[model samples]
Target: MSRFGPVKIVYSDRFLLHDTGGGDHPETAARLEVIWRSLKKGPLAGNIEILEPRQVDRGLLLSVHTEDYIFRFEEACLSGMEMLGHPDNRICYESYNVALLSAGASQTGIDFLEKGQAPSRVFCCIRPPGHHSEAALALGFCFLNNVAIAAKYWQQQYGRQRVFILDFDAHHGNGIQEIFDEDPDVFYVSIHEHPTFSFPGTGYEEDRGSGAGDGYTMNIALPPGSSDAEVLKAMEDKVAGAIEEFQPDCIIAAAGFDAHEYDDMSGLAYSTRLYGHIGRHLSAWADIYCDGRLVSILEGGYSLDALGPSVEIYLGGLCLEA
Candidate 1:
């Protein structure tokens, strides 16, 4: 049994219904399937408890996304538009609802934590990955910003004002950063492939927060071909200090597995073992800084083969005893 008790997995079949017109699309239902299979058979198999997610209250969604954007997204999907603002954001009719549930997975996980329902650690396995989504626009196969909405909900519902978001996705979460950029209450830290060579073209190391939020946002830009050691180094050297100073009320991990060496989403080369290390670090930070309050929301990880094992190892690391 894991020292952390059963880690709750917030998910539902409805997540798979957000069909992205298949041909050559990296994000698909198969992604979650492989992950579920792997976890069922992997090291932490007996330590997980699965839970279905509740749809996000539209009011909660409006907390992060504009009403205009929400209306536009729903209209586009119902009107038979194949994509949203950008072609990369492929969508079908059911996508709008699925996206709301995806965002809600985080809220559900937080509810479990705050209410002392299950374990301190929870993972939201639903997706149309949210990091790339903006408040008013969709990009990089994302619609609703899951982690961001969770942070907002946590603040409003539980009064946990200081939220620390650690994003280790290969691509920058421009949406999350932009939403909380000027807000001192939520600190956004991202370690991603250098924007010069990656998508969305943001997350430069120099772009700290603005005004009252200055020095809150930290972007660690990794060069192409970067590997596990580099990621760990950034966590220990940079992220650790930031978390120490911020002393957030909760830590939200924008957990993305695409940085694995085999995943072709980005040029960075990270091993599957690296995910375990990342999980370990996050777990330790949670215990130290936030009363073991750590919630991980799925982001990007395309390679079907690597995605499964990567997630397995990550959860395994989180379940490990101190």
Candidate 2:
């Protein structure tokens, strides 16, 4: 049904076990449930292949997070603590294991790509989203830094050294930026609502990478009312050039739909249709720069109504003929 081969969706039912107390928390198991139901019934249904995620190795987690912090997180969850370092990062007893599996989704995806698997485009529909998580702290409802760990695994395991991570979440991924800010090998790029108006508040146009990695970090901070035109303009005008210059060995997309106009998580006014364009642009970049080697990990997107459709549209664009 799709021009491209079936897109691999790396996921597992265990991700639902990471409970968030279920009251008014936007990031809940239902988030993944909505996405799964939508994908199964959407136009891309026939083009999707579901795969279970494997548990991530502790050494792989240590690649980005500190050993003490890792121990703290596990102890907190296992000891029946309601939350981690912050109240926003609500966790249940099973959250620690589920977070590991969430991080593992990306590694599983990378493995599929390196093995010359059927689908070149892989999307890890995981939750307990990881972009906002820092090495020593768990902020913004995230546990393990999923995308960051995946980038490290790709480099260490497969020797794909020059990795480019493009995060399009409503809130800046401070954790991701911090992890690779001083590393020249991994380039971290983010396009998010300006930190001045959003949470975790780190990304700024001038916050380029430090020493040895200067200019590797590119941040495009959009105003509160920014729309699809502005996002596309930024992509075409800035992101395109950066990707061309980097010529990365692989691209990891921190895909987030919270910027959608209907989603209350952010002030950005992006529409459901905008996600398709985002996917298309990323797909084209993958084709040109990395031999279609792209792994997209789910990030933010809280609107129950809009999130599902936005994800479906994004996958539709990724599967489109380049």
Candidate 3:
């Protein structure tokens, strides 16, 4: 059952059909389009605002990534070369701007929260998801750390002492964890499959925060066959419990649909209903602790059919009490 009501959803047509080097690309605009088109059939569709996508300036990216990294990423886009490890995830020349815009939508969502907008909740449906891209490398079809930069922006701009990042991606958000692993003020929590069999593999329970950031970073590695019930329990009992203790001013969700049973990427079996339940839980947490400031950034989910219904369930759950 859901508890929150009428969350203001924001999206862009640019996100719905942006081209990222086409042809079997995992992170294609069709992914966003399917979700958008499907959601329009539901009652929650009326509340969504499909706005034009905007560009993210280098200054905002500089906050989280080094200038060298950004330049290299742009060069890769221009050169039409796959990044070192991900030969298949490279973008075309035009894709550089698209990636930045997608990231900008995330930053804009944060901006809306800072401005005290209605719903005080935003979900960036654009991608080239940024959880796996490291400080310099653009792996996993990701270029910049969108959610990380937004979280850091909140901390720097609002003087938020504590920021909680709840990443539920099937794969660990290695880039985000790496960027804030040593920062006490930022708490990175992920409930992902153990990295051993996963790509970019690093989020272990023992990978807790370092030095001043100790005990703040927590990872709950689910086995490949973990079910939806386990996921809910981990969130309600473990993840939520930790957040309540930390009392963060804001919550950033690395909301990935890849765990969907129908998704091609991972073996985690979760129904769309479970994603709704998760979204509702996160919304409740935001209402109680963070003054309802929660921003969800899309990560990975390749199945078009599952992706649309999954997002619809999540947004509907956030907006309609059940």
Candidate 4:
């Protein structure tokens, strides 16, 4: 009864090679481990497919990131620097390579969705999360703007212009907004905790993009302690109408789980079940606007115990419409 084809998860164990200095690092490799383990035994055990991701092509990486920045990042990792730009952006000698693989995961999904086969959702459960990364700067533990790169690939490779991105992470996707702020082709909408109380502090309602892309960027910030009700209301009232008018050819979700009450990474108090609602919203929207051609790239979700269950529930809801 799947509305689309089977759900595919683009992942690679080699992603674990990008060491984050280990210990209590929030962006640990264990994040992916738990999700992988949970999915194997979780309700959707037999219902999903797991596939390895190819390293992103250099051209694809250059589309969103600057040449100088990419080279600087590569040098930092190769030179044995413990971190890149900041303490949060930890790295290992192999991190540069691992990050490329992480960024490439979504493109592999896009390739599947673009094929003439029936449409299905792809979840890129990659690590060293990418939404926080800017073109030339690394912030909040992200090195490459994975979602933005995939959005670019969707347009360039498949000619699917007008890519719509929905980011529901607890923290706003500053990198994603900034990268495509002036590009009318990509519409970036984010629902995150207010900037006043969040890290990186960029997504604000007043900053509605610039130039020809003005009004394309929408930032909806829920106050602290926000729960499912506030989020769903905003989606129905604001997000949905804008997306309908945009009529995107493809959809990319910056799916983050730190907003869950248990995660404590954000003040927003979304429950684990809230993710399913989020997933259902994306699933319905994908079916309606993009023929179920939706891809979700992992963003932030650090709660060791909660991240796994939250992701499983989200994936289940993503496919529930079938």
Q: Select the stronger candidate by lDDT from 1 and 4.
A: 1
Collision count for each candidate, in order: 0, 0, 1, 0
| lDDT on C-alpha atoms for all candidate structures | 0.91, 0.91, 0.78, 0.90
Off by over 4 Å in 4: 1-5
lDDT per residue as tens, model 1, 57-176: 889899999999999999999999999977788999999999989998988888888888445679999889999888898999999999999999899998999999999999999999
Candidate 3: give the clashing pairs: 6-319
Worst 10 residues of 3 by lDDT: 1-10
What TM-score quantifies how close candidate 3 is to the native fold? 0.92
Candidate 4 lDDT, 195-216, residue by residue in tens: 9999878899998889989989
CA displacement after TM-score superposition, residue 5 of candidate 1 (Å): 1.6
Model 2, range 1-322, lDDT digits (tens) per residue?
6645788999999999999998999999999999988998988777788878998888999989999998999999999999997789999999999999999998888998889645467999998999988889899999899999999999999999999999998999999998888899989999999999998788999999999999999999999999999999999999999989999999999999999999999999999999999999999999899888899999999999999999999988887878
In model 2, the runs with Cα more than 4 Å from the true position are 117-119
Give the TM-score (vs. native) of candidate 2. Answer: 0.98
